[model samples]
Target: MRCAPSAGAALVLCAATAGLLSAQGSPAQPEPPRFASSDEVNLLAHGLLQLGHGLREHVEHTRGRLGSLERRLDACGAACAQASGTAAPPPAANPVVGDAAAPETLRNLQVQLKAQDTRIEQLFEKVAQQQRNLEKQQLKIENLQSQVRLLAPSHVEHKVIKPARGKRLPKVAQDGDTAHNASRLHRLPRHCQELFEEGERQSGLFQIQPQGSPPFLVNCEMASDGGWTVIQRRQDGSVDFNQPWEAYKAGFGDPQGEFWLGLEKVHSITGNHGGRLSVQLQDWEGNNESLQFPVHLGGEDTAYSLQLTAPVASKLGATAITPNGLSLPFSTWDQDHDLRGDKNCAKTLSGGWWFGTCSHSNLNGQYFHSIPRQRQQRKKGIFWKTWRGRYYPLQATTILIRPAVDASAS
Candidate 1:
């Protein structure tokens, strides 16, 4: 097989050929020009020598780098073998011989080295891309931090105002005093004063003592049905029936329309069996009847209520003249019977004033006697029972009364 000469050997062969050609040139060929001085020739030779030295140094550096790379690749191969749980192959023999096969092997090694260099360049590009991505993410984080700083103050402003522990806070009235007074005036139905007077007169007939300071505050109104309803019961030292009387009266009165009278904070005395249960009626007035009948305690829920009907004066009988000169003759249903003219109205045997059915009579067959259940806890608030049997708290400090609507109209 034939082999190509190396670069240095080829250069030497070319120089020798040129010398021979010059010596064998024909006489007709013109002689080439020579340097004018030996110093000029020497200067040119020095330049060539320097260039050759530089080339040699570059070649040597390249060889050293290539050797280092080979060593590193061998080390990496061994490590990969170890990681893979395999024995490394034996090292290949060096191809330093001056033969065609040796040259071919060297060329193959050069091609492998170039391929490794290209793979290394690709890895460097990936690292650069990852670094750029990291920088972009860092910039985004900084921008978000700046936005949060800008919005922090407004968020703090919206924070809720928490009250101090173990301290009671006074309620802030939504409507001012003037507005409240205006609302009261607006809610007052026509002929409210007359209804208030009638309730007071009837209460006196039953010997129902007024409770709380200024016992009577004429702030009630007449309902659409001409029935009187309590609007507010703000008397001191009394249980405030904050609900309007019209709401309770509507449940019993005739659908076609009926008159009702409500008294606020009347007194009641009850004698059950041998035990006596006395409670000051919050907003009811009817009779001063006393009972000696056997009464069960805590067995059943029973209450005493006062039902006053207007336009039923004929059923009530003659008006009883009082010392105060307030003549009010209204029918009153107490316990189970009508005590309009019963002289023993204050003294009874089995019934006096209870919400349950009485053998004597049920007033006009209207069940209008019910006192709200007192809360077991000592909370100073009122709760109303809904039809669904749920109790909801109320902040009723005022009473409101309006005329009852006709049943037909409703």
Candidate 2:
């Protein structure tokens, strides 16, 4: 093999070096300390800067290791080439000539070379994993830095806010827009909220306190059946889920169709809307299943909103499913095959997680991307009894509305 110069590796090394230097030590020196209104917040900035420097040190260490590994790899390649170039000795004139054993020197060298090759391969994998870990850590430190910036007076801002319940959305019902259901009622029962609102971030399991009382804990999980599933905490950090199976079975609390993953709710509105529902998820991998048609509660006159979005229009669009049991096409995404939400009602008392038949479905001359493309991948009409009887129609994008309470008067 011919040896060729590679600029790629050189570029990677340069970038890694530069990144480490910039993160660890700034070229400029700091001026004398000035007092700040919030000393704690100012200290936070200082602490974060220190942490950033430490993270930069860690990065430099990893890059140094990477550089070392690259050199070793290059050396291995050179050695391998040299070995290949030194052709094996021509067949001995006499097969028995080796009876005297032509010095085992070459033989040991070959063995050593093979062992080194194996070691190099192992090192490559190790270095790759290390690089990934370093990248992930750097990302975490950067996020911390972002948080620190939030402490700076120039970086922070204050804003007034109106209540969300009465707010008018940009797109009218006729214009095809919706409001998803979510909330921040910390005082509500633990079984009511699916996520915790921590100032800005929402986490799957979080701690919340209201009215200066003790903090309560909650864990979130999406069920096929509507209502909330909590990771209730015991006196210790242990958790329990004493929920009934019905609340979790397919076609009940979960999304109406196939999903990559699903959630019970996204609280934007504070009130108990109609028909408590489950989440439906989707992604690149396919999920073929029947889908549940949207079911609204209360009379037709009640005000309702939805929040839905998808790739592009080539597929179907995000939609608002009403309890009235009507199939309404709302929006479009990515050409036509991007995202489609077509409603399907169970004609036979039988269905699944979302609720729809499994099979090839062409969306009005458009493509519908999904998985489980086999006959068995069908959402239902068959084995839903084994796996909850609810199948989500792949065509059903998703539904977002505050679930309606079964006990609430319509």
Output the number of the TM-score-best candidate.
2
What lDDT score belongs to each candidate, Candidate 1 first? Answer: 0.30, 0.32
**Residue 367 Cα positional deviation in candidate 2, in Å, after optimal superposition:** 15
What TM value does model 1 have? 0.17
The best candidate by lDDT is 2
* Residue 125 lDDT, candidate 1, scale 0-100: 50
**For candidate 2, lDDT tens digit of each residue in 282-318?**
3233453333332333211221232212221112222
- In model 1, the Cα lDDT at residue 150 comes to 34
Error of 2 at 60 (Å): 24
Q: Estimate each model's TM-score.
A: 0.17, 0.24
True-structure lDDT of candidate 1: 0.30
* Candidate 2 segments exceeding 4 Å error: 1-20, 31-129, 132-394, 397-410
